[model samples]
Target: MKASDEFQAPGLDLFSFPPLWPGAPYWLTKPTLMAVVGAVLICVLMWAAFAKPKLVPRGLQNIAELGYVFIREHAARPFLGKDADSWMGLLLSIFFLTWIWNLMGVLPFVQLPVSSFLAFPAVIAFSVYVIKIYVGVREQGARDYVGNLIPRGLPKVAYVLLVPLELLQNFVTSLFTHMLRLAANMFAGHLILAFFSAVGFWFLFERPTLLGVPVGVLGVVMAIVMTGFEMFIQFLQAYLFVLLTAMFIGASLNPKH
Candidate 1:
């Protein structure tokens, strides 16, 4: 479809969306590919940096070390406590993995951000949720962990009413919501960007000069503005995912009542 014939952006039209190929596999979509590539790249980069442990770290090792220290001392330790060392490896892996995937969205050629897909972000969130639940149960025992929803000072009758509600509402729902929130935000943001970008392009190049060019220019302006917004959102979403995961870990560690 020509870009400027209609006022609406063609990119956002579900019926006329671009296909990567005639019939790509579910796992081979642009977003999925970007995520996979980003993950592999991060792994190789880390291995290259730290393979030869050095007394005087330089190059990538030095940069990687600084990152590790930040997450270990600041992110994991505060929430997971002294035992954070045990889980620090996992947290660092996830943090860098997430950061790289989000970073890929803006990079040329690998413009697709995997986390923008609901499936990808959902998988990550679910993984963190499972680990959080496992930690809580393992440390506190299932019974105690389950009992933690209700406060300690509640009366006996209140416990009967509140415990189930707390468990049903906060603990259970938060996990799902955490994943959905990230997925939804990324998904919507990416789509909006696509729409506006397409509209801007169509207006600039396809339609008649007087009408199409001016509208397209406006569209391009909006796209630039949104692109800036997307960059900010990308970082914020990554931060929220990791931060919430850590907070959940903290909650699980201390099963109250």
Candidate 2:
């Protein structure tokens, strides 16, 4: 078969999978199932690490302790400062869950990242948003919270433009961007992988010819290299998710007036 005849490029449809439960809605599908699995994995890991604390950490506890230190120093401290320790549990969990959710994109059979679906990342972003609003109102009082959102020393005239922008920034845009950041990265990464994988399969297995053999080899190699790159992006996005959450929480605690 001619290359054009045999090879069909993948598209957004590559992300769609028929539901495991035929009647289930589009939102309840493989990506969601993988998220559920990621949560279970996190629970088991935490249990192994801290089910019974030891004065001298070893094995899973050692790893978990190291993770705690990483989250505290890297994710929490820069934003949270004195509040870091108190927020460790929530930040650590969010970091790990987001990390694993992105990881599923590259794992062998489970090649779908839950965060790519938007709804998966929505949970974490929405949770952080609620915490930010609640903490701001509870700690600063409602009027102060609104005042804090407005920049100090601004001319009275500037308040008209700045207030609506800051209000939208704090309330709507923050959460929307947070969710989009994670989902867009994962979605684009997975789609790239699918494209290269499809190319390799088309040239090598579907309609291989001597002329296309080298092209197939190149396609597979590129896919493998991109997969490794995708793994790094996944971890980075996960860390970023936690970092932004901490930043938002910190702002709410001590708003930038």
Candidate 3:
């Protein structure tokens, strides 16, 4: 088979198809397209939801209200306490943006989720980390915040080993894990979907013998199952990301627990 013929596979070929730009702006990439589309969609949805400004909320207002309530009550309240009212909008933004980006990866023509990239998640994580540290220092003062790491009643000898571990785990390691958790989940899930989808086509078109048909059917079944699974993971990873952010912020603001 020619190189072109060999390159032809199911999900693999989907990405192999020419990008919107061959040698131009980076924004023209597939993942960027998804991110842009997700952002636009959210903006439109927000506008529709709030444009009328109904008291009872008939259409989009209802959805907007529900989202507001969910983040406020379920996510922010439990983590950030009564003070979370100030951070509600920020938390909501991250929650929905993460969700939309995850869902965007599954869409046709824009199969990549930018959140799957470390740069995107890192940006978010770093921002949140900065906010957390800022609030921590501001609320407790740098002395108190740093002091909180040492257990209130720990022996002087134990401080030698425990202090570094506590600081590393709570302050440093957390940021890395929080960011990578979202990015890795999306990246791995999308890649698996692509692989399975490509293999399915390879089975059907490249090898059409009696054995190939059943295998192709199996591949298709796997692809469908994986896609459904990815959708769930996408939402879950987004929620987890937001939830962790809330938790971290909560810890920084109130680390007594």
Candidate 4:
């Protein structure tokens, strides 16, 4: 058995998709379609879950109520304090939307997390950035907002350098970090899951050999293990994404201590 006979690993090209339609518009790739579909599905779920308030909460209402509590407690209350319930709707939407995007990656037919693509997360992160700034301005007057954002206790000599740096940190750096945190996790998770699935498929069926049997089994095991871990990560990332958003809003609403 020469070294060359061993399987070649998959590369980033695996994440790339050619045109779904050779002659159609270029933007209509699987990831784009999936993202749109996921958004629509979220709208439907929200409507179904809470269109009319129920006295006792059955089925979807029960689920919706639980979600409301979870999002308020975990993503909103700690940051927003007494004003938590006021922002539950937006926080809930962000949490569920991101979760659905990630769940798509693990679903049988749809194997890609739309958020793995940078555009989706960037859009949401930028939206949060815009809202955070807007709320800051509205809550603290333009002058005070700027005054509150930069570090307070620093010496006057440090202000010359720190002001611009802190402003950049508050806006631009937060935007980049918010988007990258979500996208990078989804991208890496999708790649890993795909790698193991590919290994299992290739070795167990496509070109089965005595030497490949153990490798194939290992791949299957790893894929399962990673899938469980990825699910945990998916939930955690969604929480973190919204938690950061709440923090941003909260920070903007009140001066830093």
Candidate 5:
């Protein structure tokens, strides 16, 4: 038989998961379960870390505190400043939950990132959008909130162009990009990893030949390298998502005139 007959490349089907059980609903797929698991894991970790205060933190508490401090300083404080502590709970959850969602893509038997599904990131981004608008309106008043979208000091005629542009950017573009950024990264990363892994599996195991062996080895090597790189990207995406959230909230609270 031809080697080509035995080897098949992975495709978009890699991202499409079936229900976990025979009778499960369409929504109860691997990604959905993993998302719920990620949320629960975050809650458990937070409870374990903070439920019992300790003067000298150790083990899980120490590790969790390190993550907390990292988000506060890098994600929250730099953007939210004085209000950082007040929003730590939300910021910390967003950072850790997002990280876990992305990390799921690498785990054995559960190689699907929840955020790879557009719905997951969309919901989170939409929530942040609603919160931003609410806070902006509350802090700046309805009139000022809308007015602040376009900065002053332009030619009077500029408002004709800038007004609509600013409105579209602030309301429509920001929300879509915020969600799509994270989802697109995760989706593309998972697809690349799957392709390389499929190549390695097919060439090495399913259709092993003298000529195919070297290609299989190359595929395996690339998969390993890409996995490490993808892991870094996963963490970076999580950090950026939270960072942008903090920035949006900060901007709402303190609009630049």
Candidate 6:
């Protein structure tokens, strides 16, 4: 059989899902359900971890505290400094929720990363964008907030070019990039995993042959390797998203910085 005929790699259709139930709305698809599940899971886990406080933490509390401290120290404190503790709740939610969303891709029977749906990441990014603008305006005042986008010491002639560019970068490009970065990474990672998994299944079970066995083994091995790497990417993207968020809020609060 022809190679193309033997194995058709997964495509964009892999990301598409019908409604979760018959007669359900088009929007009630797998990604939407998984997104909700992820959010609920985070809430439940948080409650389990912190619903009752302990003087010396153990089990879930210990794990949750570690995550809290990690976000506070790594993602928030560096950017927001003294204000970091005030923002820990927001930062922690963003980090864990995003990581869970990305993590859903590897889960059995629920292997769809919610962030792969642009709408999910877009919502978070837009929310942060609004908060950033609001905090900047509130903390720095409207005029100063806008003025802060333009660096202070540029030559007057430089303002002609720098102002528009800085404005665009701060207002438009940053928002879109923030949304796209998370969505694009999860989308591509899911596709890659699907492709490798499909290859292994196709070659091994669907069309087993002496020549195809090695290729199938390679596919399985690569899928395993990619799964590990993808998990790291999932966590890293979550961290980066929260880090950028803290940076945006920090910049708003300290425009000169």
lDDT of each: 0.74, 0.90, 0.82, 0.89, 0.93, 0.93
- Report the number of backbone clashes for model 6: 0
In candidate 1, residue 87 scores what lDDT?
Answer: 75
Output the TM-score of candidate 4: 0.93
Query: Which parts of model 3 are misplaced by more than 4 Å?
Result: 1-28
Q: Compute each candidate's TM-score over C-alphas.
A: 0.83, 0.94, 0.88, 0.93, 0.96, 0.97
lDDT of 6 by residue, 65-162 (tens): 99999999898988898999999999999999999999998998988889989999999999999999999999999999998788887689999999
The lDDT-based order of candidates, best leading, equals 6, 5, 2, 4, 3, 1
**Candidate 1 lDDT, tens digit per residue, 60-100?**
99988987888877677778786788777777777787777
What is the Cα-based lDDT of residue 234 in candidate 2?
96
Worst 10 residues of 2 by lDDT: 1-10
On the 0 to 100 scale, the lDDT of residue 95 in model 1 is 75
After superposition on all C-alphas, the RMSD of every candidate to the true structure, in Å, is 3.3, 1.8, 2.9, 2.0, 1.5, 1.4
lDDT of 2 at 160: 89
Steric clash pairs (candidate 6): none
Q: Candidate 4 clash total?
A: 0
lDDT of candidate model 6 versus the reference: 0.93
Per-residue lDDT tens digits for candidate 3, residues 1-257, read 66765534444343342457677665566666667777788888888888779878887788778878888887898999987899887888898889988887788876777788777789889999999999999999998998886786768899899989988987899899999999888878887887778778887887666877888788889999999999999988888898898898998888883
Per-residue lDDT tens digits of candidate 4, residues 1-257?
76656676777886788778888678888988899999999999899988997899999889978988998988798888987888888899999999999888899989889888999989999999999999989989889998887877778999999988988999789999999999999999998998998899889987788999788999999999999999999889988999999999988876674
What is the Å distance of residue 58 in model 3 from its true position?
Answer: 2.9
In model 1, pairs of residues that clash are: none
